[model samples]
Target: MGIEIEVVYALPDEQVVIPVNVEPAATIQDAIRLSGILERFPEIVLEDRMVGIFGRCMALDHPVQAHDRVEIYRPLHASPADARRMRAEARRRRRAGK
Candidate 1:
């Protein structure tokens, strides 16, 4: 039997969510391919990006379940540590100016 799932990808200005159905044994990668998300978003390269289910990171080979929300993650421009450091520095500079 086929399982129902949603595949999503977000951009700064837009988000795309596509509903798909796949075999019960299908993996995240399989659902993504069936969703036609890659064709719609040519910039997405599976090998270079990460996939997940309901916001939790998982391997492309991870088996999918019914009602799963398969998400394709974009590469972070900055690491969490770097982002935090930058924000703190900015806050410090603003405080000093006041």
Candidate 2:
């Protein structure tokens, strides 16, 4: 028998959820490939994007358990440093009555 798992991906306005059954020994990547999420989300690149389970980043080869929810992460539009800098600038402007 195979284990059932959910694969999820999200966009700014949409979410893609896929349910699949794979061997208990299957890796997270295996379930992802079997779920066909790549076909559904052309923008998703396994090589560049991150994958996780239950909100924790994980390796693609990580083993999957029954009912595990795998997630595909999109690349960040802005780096953390850049975001912090931008926010600081905005705060300064607001304080200065700009």
- Best lDDT among the predictions, by candidate number: 1
lDDT of 2 by residue, 1-98 (tens): 99999999988999888999999899989989999998977777897889999999999999999999999998888999999999999999999995
TM-score of each: 0.92, 0.84
> What is the overall TM-score of model 2 with all chains considered together?
0.84
Listed per model in order, the count of residue pairs whose N, CA or C atoms clash below 3 Å is 0, 0
Task: Summarize candidate 1's per-residue lDDT along 7-83 as a digit string, tens digits.
Answer: 99999999999999999999999999999998989999998899899999999999999999999999999999999
Best by TM-score: 1
Error of 2 at 24 (Å): 0.3
lDDT of 1 at 46: 95
Error of 2 at 35 (Å): 0.7
